[model samples]
Target: MKKTGEKTWQLRLYVAGQTAKSITALANLKKICETHLAGQYEIEVIDLVQNPKLAAGDQILAIPTLVRRLPSPIKKIIGDLSNETRVLVGLDLRQG
Candidate 1:
């Protein structure tokens, strides 16, 4: 159970495997969360290669997808996530 008004970001990263792009996305996501959300966020990595059924839950159509499942109104960003500015905007951490 979550406390009301207490922000805890629930993030899900959908990846095929430990590919370079998937690894990069995870690294970038961690860096951003550490810089912004810090302890206020939880990340769940889902390897579609191992569990392909999980992708349907999030409707994942691409590799290295970042899904923001908490804080209402789910959002997704697909890529290696190397572009910091774009990632920040995509995650709604900053206004575009």
Candidate 2:
């Protein structure tokens, strides 16, 4: 359960399957969240391979897409998330 007043960073990662790109994206996401958002975040991984319909909701055009669903003004970053700086900037964690 979540506290009424606490804010949590909600992230959704869209991937097709357990491909190398998907695995890498997930790993990088974990590390980034731990280093930045810490315990104040939640990750919801959506495997399109399991449920292709879920992709439409997020308008996912590619695999390994990370969507920031919280903190308003939803944001998106597409790729394997190999670049920490790019991820951070895309997520609004740092200046572009």
Q: RMSD in angstroms, all models?
A: 2.3, 2.3
lDDT of 2: 0.92
Off by over 4 Å in 2: 1-7
Best by lDDT: 2
Task: Write out the backbone clash pairs for model 1.
Answer: none
State the lDDT at 96 in candidate 2: 94
- TM-score for each predicted model, relative to the true structure: 0.91, 0.92
Please, what are the lDDT tens digits per residue for candidate 1 over residues 1-96?
A: 589745579998999989999999999999999998987888989999999889898899999999999876899999988999998898889999
**Candidate 2 least-lDDT 10 residues:** 1-10
Whole-structure CA lDDT of model 1:
0.91
**Can you write out model 2's per-residue Cα lDDT over 1-96, one digit (the tens) per residue?**
557655578999999989999999999999999999987998999999999988888899988999999877899999999999999999999999
